[model samples]
Target: MGVKVTGTVAAGWETVRAEFEAVVAAQPHSPEAQLAVRHHGRTVVDLWAGEDTDGETLSGVFSITKGAAHLVVALLVQDGVLEPDRPVVSYWPEFTGHGKERLTVRDLLAHRSGLINTPEGFTIEELADDAFIAARLASAEPYWEPGTAYGYHAFVIGALTGEVVRRATGRSIREIYEERVRAPYGLDLYMGLPSEAQERWKPVLEALPTPAQLEIQAAAGPMPELLPVAFNWHTDPPMDLVAYANHPLVKAQGPASAGGVGTAAGIAGMYAAAIGEVDGRPALLKPETVAEFAKLHTPGLDRVVSEPDHFGLGFERQPAVGPEAFGHCGAAGANGFADPVTGIAYGYTRRRFGFPGGPAPENLPLTAAVLKVARASS
Candidate 1:
C-alpha cells in the first residue's frame, strides 16, 4: 500500500481558532484556503480550509506570487548572477532608451522606475511579452522621474524584472524559479500556473459593500474621500481586468510584481525557506543578502495607490493594514507576506473580486490570523 502523505507541521496543531473563523466569516465565498507558520525552522501552524473548483479543497493566492518572484532574484544575488545596484540597461540595453539608462536594479525592484500604469492605450497582453513591453517602456516617458519619486508599478514590475532574469540567466523566469527555489524546497507555487491545476483554483466571489458602497460608508467617517476613483483601476473595461488576470499571457509570463498563483501553505513555506533554510539545505540568500533586500528604500505616499506604501528592494514592508510583513498584495484582494522577526510567513488566496477602496481589509484578515498563530507559536 502507498504511504500516506501529510504536512510536517500538522502534528502539533494549536489552531488560531477564533481569529481564523473571524477572517473567513468576514470575506465572501473564499473556498479552499490554507495558512502556515514556522519559527526557527519549526512548524507552529499548518491549516487548510474551503475547497477548489473540483471540490478538492485548496486556496489560490494572487499577487503574493510577486514575493516568490522576488525570492528568485534574491537567489540570483546570492549566487552572484545579479547585483542590485547595477544599471538595468547593462543587462537589457534597450532599457537604456527613454531616459531610463540610469535606472538601477534596485529602482526596478522598488517600483520607482517610473514605468507605472503601462501608458493609456497599451494592451495588457503586452505585459506578457517582455521584449515588446521593454521596448514600449523604452520609448515611453516616465510618469515621474525615475528614482526621484515612488509609484506602485502595478503590472509593470513583473515584466521589467522578469526580463532581467531572462537576460541574465538565459532561462525563463518560471524555469529558474522552479529549479532554484520551488523544487529545492518542494513548495507548490507558480508564476505560470498549469492548466491542469486550474481545478485547484477557487471561484472568487465578489465581495460585498463594493467600492461605491465603501465610498458611501466612508462618507460617514472622517476619511470620506479616502476611497477614490484612482483605486478603481480594475473596473476599466478597456483593460478587461479579470480576463487579463486569468489569461495565459498573464499566467505564463512572469510578472515578478503581480502575476503569480499559489496557496498560503506554499507561500508561507517558501518565505520560511528564505529565513529558515529549507530542510538544512543552503538558503538561496545569505543572511546579510536577505538583510540587504529587507532595507526600506522608499517609504512614503505612493503615486499610484496614493497611500503611504513602504517598499524594500522588492517587498512591501509593514503595511498599515497588516503586521510587520513583507510581501505583495493583489488588486482583487489577495495577499502573501513573511515576518522574519517572528518567523511567520503566510499566503491567503481568495476568488472574491471587489472594486478597489472597498470596506474589506483585503488580506488583512488573513494577516491578522497569521500573526495570532505566530504569536502563539513564539
Candidate 2:
C-alpha cells in the first residue's frame, strides 16, 4: 500500500499535491516527509506522509542550520553591528597567523576560508560543542589561501561565525535566535532542542541504497582525501553522521552548522519571516540586505565537494528554484530556500537518510511544480 499523504493545498495548488504524492510514492522507503511553502508571506501548502510523521514532527536538518546561523549574521550586518569586510582576526584576535590574517567575515560566510576540519577528526561530543570547534580552529592554517578558493567547511562554519557573533554581541547565536527570530516568530525550528520537546522529535532513519546505486558509488572510486576530513571522518572508525546527528547531546547542544532541528513548516516560516511580513511583523531583512547576501560569491568549482557548487554569503545559490533563490540543503534529503523575486519560501524535510545524500532528486520536480503553479496564480 502507498503511504497516505495528509494536508491542505490552496485552491490553485492542486498540482503541488499531485507532484508531492508522486515523489513520496517513488521513494524506496516511506519518506516520512513534510513539505511546506509560503507565497507572499502566507502558508499555501502544508503536507506530510508516512507513519509517525506530520507537519509538526521535528528531525535533524543537517546543514540547513547554516541558513539560521547566517541569518543571524545577516541581521548583525544589517544592524551595522558586524562588518563583513573586516578581518576575522579583528573580532577574534587568536585567529591570526597561518596565512589567515587576511581572512574576512565575508570569506568565512562564503566558505572560502579553507579551514574545513582538523587532520585528526573530532569526537561526536566535540562536534556538538560550537565553542570547542571554534577554539580548535582559531589557530589552524587554511588548506589554501584564505580568500583564493571555496570549500565546504562542513562542520565548523557556524563555530567560526558564531565565535564572531559572540565577540560582537556577547550572546550566543542560539540565544539571539530565540530572542529575535524563533520565539518571536513562534517557529518550531530550534538551535538547541530542549529535553521537554523530545516527544515531538522523530529520529532519522538510515539510507537504503539499491545494489545498482552502490555500484555507481563504487565506480566513482575511492573517497577523496579531503572529503573524509571535511566530513569529520578522517579518524580510524570514521564518524557515523547518522549516529552523530541522532545523539542526544548533539541535539541538545545544536551546533549551528548541522544541528538544527525543525519541521518543514518551521523552516519555511523562517524564510517567509526573512523576506516578507509574517503575522503583521515586517520582514527581518531589508531588501538591500537580502540582495547583498544572496548575490553569488562563489560561483565556480568548490575545492572540497569538487563540484560546480555556488554559494552566497551564507546560503547556497539555488538557481534551479530561481536566479535569486538562496538557501541550504541538508544531508538527509532536506532543503529550504527563499526567492525574493517570486516571493516564495519553501521547505522540505524527510526522516530518512536519502540514497545519494545532499538535496534529493525529488526537489527538482517538486519545486518546478510549485513554481509553475505560483507563477500561474500570481
Candidate 3:
C-alpha cells in the first residue's frame, strides 16, 4: 500500500504529495518513510508510509537527526551561550591535546579540525559511554593538522560538539534540546529516544553493495578514513539494522552532528521554529545567526565522502539541488533541511540503504519537485 499523504498548506502540497507518492510506490515495502514539507509556518505535506517489522510504526532516521542537533547549537549561539569562533580549548581545554590548541569551534563545526574518526577502535559500549568516548577523543591525535583542511569527522564531530555543549552549559545535549528547542516548540523529536519508542523503530531494509562496488568507491577519490565499510557494525555481536536503530551511540544526547532520532513531522516542526515563530514561540535563531549559518564556511570536496559538500556554521548550504537551499543530507538517503528564501523546510527520511557506488538516486529530485511548487505558488 502507498503512504497516505494529507496536510494543510498552500498549493505546494499537491506537488509534494505527488512526488512523495511516486517515490514510495517505486520503493514499496520499504521499512518506513516519512516526508514533511512546510512553508511559512504551515505544514503543506506531512505523510508516512510502510511500517516497522512489528507493523504500523515508523522507521528511525539516522543522520537526519543531526539537523535537529545542529539547531540546538545554533540556538545556543543565538542566546549568546556559545561562541563559534572562540578556541575550543577555551571551553574544554582538554580538547587542545596533540597540537590542537589552535582549533576553534568553527573549525570543528566546519569539519576542518582533522579529527575524523575515533582512533581507539571504539566498541558499541565505548561509543555509547560518553565519558569513555570523550576521553579517547581528548587523547587522540588529528588525522591531519587542524584547520588546514576539511574531512567529515563522521562519529567524532558528534562527540566533540556534545562535549562543548556539555562544558559550556552544565547540561546534556539532549536536555538542552528538549528544554530550549523541542518542548518550547512542542516538537516530538529526541536525540535519545526513550525505550518506549523502541517499538516504533523500523529497521533499514535495503541491502548493502557488494565488495566490488565498495572497492570502486574507495578508489574513486579522497574518502574519510573513518567512513564505515559495507559490513561495519557497532554492536558487540554485530547486530546490524536493529543496533543502528536502538544503540546507545545513536540514542544518546549527541547534538546535530549525531544521536538524533525522530519523525519527519518532528524535524519539520523544529525547522519551522527556526524559520518562523512557531505558534508565537520565539525563533530558534536570530536573523544574524541565520545569516551567519547560510554563508559558506567551507566550500570544496569533502575528504570523508569524496564529494563536493558545502558547510556554513553547522548547516550544509547550496547542495547540488539548489544554490538557495541550505540543509544537511546524510549518508545513505536521509534528507532534511530548510530554505528561508522560499520559506521551505523539508524532512524526508527512509529506511532503505543506498551506498556510494550503486546507481544511487540524486538529491536534486526532491529539491526540483519542491522548487517547482514553490515557483508556481509565487
TM-score of candidate 3 versus the correct structure, residues matched by position: 0.85
lDDT of 3: 0.65
> Could you give me the TM-score of model 2 versus the true structure?
0.98
Error of 3 at 56 (Å): 8.4
Poorest stretch of ten by lDDT in candidate 3: 226-235
RMSD values for the candidates in order, in angstroms, are 5.3, 1.1, 3.9
Output candidate 2 Cα RMSD. 1.1
Per-prediction TM-score, please?
0.82, 0.98, 0.85
**lDDT per residue as tens, model 1, 1-378:** 211122334443434544555565554455334555566555665555443322133333445666887888888888789988999989887776566888899888988887765435456576556567656776577777788877766666666787888889997667888887887776767776667666665434444454666877667654322122222243345454455556666666645555666666676678777876668875556777777777778878877666675688787775643434466665555556666667766655545555442123635655665566566657
Error of 2 at 27 (Å): 1.1
Instruction: Give the backbone clash total of model 3.
Output: 3
Error of 2 at 33 (Å): 0.8
- lDDT pick, better of 2 and 3: 2
Can you tell me which runs of candidate 3 are displaced by over 4 Å? Answer: 1-12, 28-31, 51-58, 195-199, 206-242, 252-256, 318-324, 356-363
- Residues 1-378 of candidate 3: C-alpha lDDT, one tens digit per residue: 554544444553576667666776665245256677777777777766554422124455656655666777888888889999899989997886776888888888887887665433555555555555666777577777888877666555667777888899987667777788877776657777667776665555655566876798778776444454212333355435435555655665433444566777777777778877678766667777788877777778776666575677767775654555556665446677777777777776656565652113534576678767866676
Winner by TM-score between candidate 3 and candidate 2: 2
The CA lDDT of each predicted structure is: 0.63, 0.90, 0.65
